[model samples]
Target: MPYPFRLNAVASLFVAIAPGAFAAEPDQIPQDMNVVIVSGSRVEHTSFDFPAAIDVVDASRIQDSQMRVNVSEALSAVPGLVAQNRQNYAQDLQISSRGFGARSAFGVRGIRLISDGVPATMPDGQGQPSAFNLDMAERIEVLRGPFSALYGNHSGGVIQLFTRDGQGRPTLEVNTAAGSDGQRKLDVNAQGSSAGIGYVLDVSRFETDGYRDHSAATRDQGFVKLTTAPTAGGKLTFTANSLEQDGTQDPLGTTWATYQANPRANEIDSTDTQSPKRTIADRYNTRKDISHKQAGLAYDQQFGDDRLHVMVYGGNRQVKQFQAFSKFLQVSPSQSGGVIDFDRDFYGADINYAFVRPLGDGKLTTTVGLEYGHSTDDRSGYENFIGNTFGQEGALRRDEQDKLKTMDPYAQAEWQVGQWVLTGGVRRTKLTVGVNDAFLSNGNDSGGVSFSHTTPVLGALYKINPLLNVYASAARGFETPTLNELFYSGSGAGFNFGLRAAESTHLEVGVKAIVMTNTRVNAALFQVRTSDELVVDTAIGGRTSYKNASATLRQGGELSVDTKLGAGFSGRVAVTVLRAVYDEAFGKVTTGSRLPGVPNANAFAEVAWKDKSERIGAALEAIASSNVYADDANADIPAPGYAILNARFNARQTWQGWNFKEFVRINNLLGRQYVGSVIVGDANKRYYEGAPGRNWMAGIGANYAF
Candidate 1:
């Protein structure tokens, strides 16, 4: 179907459902409106009254019948966000919000990631979601649109995970799961509160033989948390986490011909004369090893009608990756080689004070905050072959010391009175990046660049009635080039300081309503106009370069409806329609060309049933997305549009201080074949990454309390 038709169809479906849903009696408004969120304002407030696009995935939805290994599993129902597992653990998850981070070749960019009040993103705005410990997550709050600008640079959107605090009786739990393709997981956790102090600890390991050729991985994670009231009216929290993955194989993307021939086949290394059928991944032993550890402390104090909050965190990460670049590619002196090694240390702190007072006929709350972050990296690159032995580190090609520092000061206020709620905020951010070239054999390439921006946001919401709210918001935001993006120019030169930051203007209008007495609906229309938009210029052999393009425009609408069907049944639907394209021609990319990697439309729907005791449940889910382009010119075979079905069943039982739970799930129930994701602008046309056809997983858990 045409993109416009797909969008209209989704919109019409919502329109058809709204009238009947809103006909319920006014007195039947659900109490779910009381759910509090803190992502938009830095203070607790109901999402219904917050004038921005935000969604919350509670613990039940995050953990039930799931492997809990990747956040992508739980985020499909969130409109305006795309999270793809890639099925390649070596590169980590790919996440983009509203087309902001769609061009990312790896990891997460253009978005902010926070956990337990500490930033998971680095000072340069690159984040690794693999660091998150989902076993302890209580809820994940996703904030989009104008309000995200308040978080400073590269804040296209924000996703924050809050862990559950230990309380009640002490308990210990163990879980084990196994599935197709040799996938398996084991997890153990303990939590309790003693003498006014709370503690939680978790450890888990996951392994998979992978559905695609030459893709295999193993990961181990650990988390610890402690909470206590150290003084009257004051509470302190401490958290620590670690993640380790060694020798995770990377199944590089395949050419369209190869994918069509065999979705599970690897890209053959045509240059290998001795073994013609040997795949590039097998020939080069493409893989990555990562080790990461972090710790954070947060303290909050209440004084009458005011509050003080402070957070400090520090971490270190080490990574070694081997890429599948051919030997010929390294003949150029400017080439950074095929082996990447980096060790980084990072630390940051945030301090804020909130004051509350009465103004006119309303109550006003204001917060002033300061944030500082720093990171230093010892980086080096090496050739991937030594004496014809591929995959072994050869001669060193480049070495550098890279440092990033950021400081931001921001303030925001919220006032609520009668039927009106008003909010405004501003942030001034300064970022400095410096690189010192240690190996000058390829020529001295060292420099420093700094960027500064002041962003402001404003929003207003009006309560149309006890069951409905309408809101509008606007803001200015900016995204600076990440270290990876700046590492190489289009010509393969080192560190392109000429790259400019992308600045944007955002506008949004939305509605929040309770319908059918037991249903909640959120709908939004948004637009973003950006100058100096960052785009992929070239990609070859696992190395990608970025360049700033002409102005771009993104206009979209999002709708999410969640309702109770009674009889212990529920249903949910989330739809997104986005039109992202270049507004002006630039470098062969004509005006109106759709942005690569972003689909024109996507949707998710689910129907679930549970026993009255909530001990047995099942759900049927459908996920669909329109086709997406692979290049700036829209000149390649696009990943075809696809829809898939999934089903899951879970059961629970409790007996004398013990709890037992088990679940079984089947994905891609129809055994459809499709590409799950793409590597945009791949110069070699190896753009498609195939998803699994059909898969099953079963798990069981046992908990004991004392």
Candidate 2:
């Protein structure tokens, strides 16, 4: 739908423009030959190597794109994808595929996330959604499917984000930027190979004044990668990912009356007239720090009937999480309280084997894997108020703890002949959960363990012609409740009751084709049926508790296309359409009901023209999303949709017509007001207001050869 130009002319009197942007284009470099065996394919060979579709984001494009601080937004350059944040800089993100989704604080739905062969997820499978260092990223590979057997530990498909290996020429780079709301950034990266060893190091600092009132965010990150060769047949690699940050929340929270009066009011100003005495000091101030250590070894060699490939990995992940604030004046301004501390640790090991054999006119590939892991969560907290009466010596002190362990095994096989391929696999998992609560009102141990049944994947891929192929597949996926959801009771984010397992079955049919000599497009249509969905039962007469009364259905299509515009110019575009619904006893909703934060359709387009010899280039891009549902109840009030247009100009030419090896980019050329997403939807079924309206971000980048 197009907004009337005439209306815009009249509305200009009251509107202030804040500008920014989405666009996807064809792959920059086109490959004419080879049936590349991509990882997402649990299947072995053929043009449509795997029944489930896959997308890859390589390094060269990452650097050329001029993407800002939003990792997910930059990724929109890839077709069939769109991403947005829920909070200003909370690093909390939501991603969807084929219109199906599972909303959580971390990890992702129907997709497994592994970085450097290590599960990026914590022991509970709750992943850290914002720890990425885009500057050092080597490539991002995605596998879409419910075919979970290969890595059944997670029901979603798999997305592997590989850090830089520092191949070929030695490189040293520095990047800096300044944008709207006093946002600033400094990023540095370096890599080189010497003798028989290679090394990579990177560090960065990013800060923002925030879009809305009290919406500021700051982040610091550092990473390193090392490679060594000992024996001729083996190699060892070590890496670390870490971050520290502090941020203010949003100004968009509002009660029904405040929203009706002014949905755009900041948190400190919005209020219920009945509670006019309320003070803003009670608002929340949050912060966090996360660090991980990882290392691994791999061996590959020929062994009779098969070429052996083996990899073993182990790592430790630590999180220091904090949240607190004093001053809910209306609830009790005299009362000041918060959680003093929370800590957790995760550790794990993995072993994998892949063997291939030549058979008939085709080939056979078999893979076997084993995993053993454990997690521990220990917490202590305190709450105090300026009340008239004093209670006991240890009245407000409390402690709680939980531990979990998992041991799993899985296998799969693929056989291919002519244009036909077959694949099948299964996985069995064993789990145990234990907990302890020092302040248990019932005076009891508060922990228990549970095991999940087996989940499997089945699919096939067919080649229709040299330029195209088609596939169909079916598989099962599930999610277990988190520790906080089962034991914590008093904290607002804490849970009073346990949640049941969340499960779904996905079926899809898709096609992959090279549209022309320089363009390729991949598209898929999928549907999912889910049961035992976790939902709040306020009717239980207390805080939100989990129940399995909800059933859900999702259906959608994804299309991505990329092409070479010309010698030094290229472009890409992607679109997604989705429908999700929740069918519970209280409300039997039909299809087309949108999921929380999910837009009905998302699209992107980008074009870049470069002159490498002169070290000069310019790029233009546009990204737009349709309206989205701001609440889980599928309410009528939606987050109005908006579009962003951006442009960049870079040059390495010297002042005297000579040339240097550096360039710069400017973003949000036109300022515009916009919301990040219905990301902060309330239970009342309304959307949260978004961040700073107009931002002007500019950055300079350079690379030098040793």
Candidate 3:
């Protein structure tokens, strides 16, 4: 479809919805709703009152989504953010805010991820979101734009998940679901409060046959939280969580010809020696097995108008992965082989003090904080075959230990002056990375790099009317190379000390308004200019290198509307338009070329119907995106524009002290055949990953209280 045609379709729908948006029955309007955000300010502030682009996804939305396996399920309606499920479990989700983190092959970068006050992103900015437990999530807050820089490195944006604390009486709940492609999931949870103590615990298991060949996975997760008030003005909280993935298949990407032949086909065909009659992913057993455990403690106390908060957290992760490397590549001495093993230990602490006092007729609040974090990695690589035997570790290729440490001092202030609010923050970060080469066979190519930066943001919001606010902000942010990026230097087995950090300047202006009694609208315009932008230097046989580009530019706008229709229907729509391109060329990439892995335009719309009795409900959703490029050269095959329709129906009943509910969701109702995601800048041009056609899932749950 043409871009203009798609825009027209979306515009027509907006016109059709305007009637209901403006036709407001004051008496029918529900009480004004205010969402409190914690990610942007590390404090509580009404969403509209916050001078940034922030979005909140509540538990109800998460529980009612079709694909609860990833954050993409509930975030489709959020503008300025793109989340794609690759259907290849090994790579996890492909997430990007604006033009940031678009080139990542696996895991997330250029964005900060937090869970219940604990950092999921390491000091190097690499993050994994597979451990998020949706069953117990109270809310997820997404902060974008300049204010995100306050979080230090890789602060292009922030996604923070806060779980629910136990309340009321002791209760138990169980949930189970089954879906297309032989997917199954089960969850159990318990919560209660007693003797000034509150507790919540949840455990879940999931398995899938997957949508493509050689794509299958089984996963387990557990979470627990305990909270108590030990003194009159003090509170303490402890949280623990663990995740395990026994088998996650890596289907890998496919070439344009191969995708045209069979989108589900693996990289290797039937003539390879590894199997002679099977695909490479199946024959070589390309997969990853992983285990992770994390725990954290938080303390809060108040003394008159001054407050104190402290947090301590630690975690460890172990992973083993097998890849499909051709025999020719394995013959080279420089090749790192196809088997990877890594164990990581990370720990961090944060302490802050807040003071509130009177300034003139208004009030001024100031916060001072310090944070420290450290991580160590024991990494090794080995050949995937020995003699005629495949799928087993052979000769050791690379072995090393890498360590990263970071310390930051930060301060922020917010002042209320009559009809205006001023906010500002600054953070000074110091980071050091070191490596030790343990395998003398490759020579001692060990070296380290250190980086330091100071980022600051300033913003102001003016309340023109009781229901309208306008704000503008600007900030400087920087991103250091991730540990994985530094793992290999083209010269040999050593750190990539030649790589430089990318720095950016972000500017944004936005408005928030209550257009009607039951209608709200928010919009923002943003621009970012980056120096020494990171780009893929080389990618060969599953191994990659990175370098810095001269410059890049990103400009975009986002619009969102939420309104409550008459009776029990509510509707929401969000649209994003972006123009991201290289300002200066690097290698074969040319100036003015569109950045890879980002769609120029995307939109989401949803309408839901519920009853006052709260026993029955239904929802209809639509998601659409423009075409996206898969390579920096802008000439490799592109994923075409696509639209998907989904419907969900749910109902619940209460009897005695027990509650029972059921839900059914149908996705891709139009049976759309399209590419779901891509691996950016694949040297062999194997970049496409296909999405599944029409699928369905049904779930049932029961809760009992005493």
Clashes of 1: 0
Best by lDDT: 1
Q: Which stretches of candidate 3 lie over 4 Å from their true place?
A: 1-32, 65-67, 269-277, 327-336, 490-493
Candidate with the greatest TM-score versus the true structure: 1
TM-score of each predicted structure versus truth: 0.97, 0.82, 0.95
Candidate 3: deviation at residue 69, Å? 2.4
lDDT of 3 by residue, 162-252 (tens): 9999889999999999999889999999999999889999999889999988899988999999999998788899999998997798888
lDDT of 2 by residue, 206-312 (tens): 88776555456777777787776666655567767666664334233433444445434444423435345442312333334444455555444444544444555
Q: Regarding lDDT, does 1 or 3 come out ahead?
A: 1
For model 3, which pairs clash? none
Order of candidate numbers by TM-score, starting with the best: 1, 3, 2
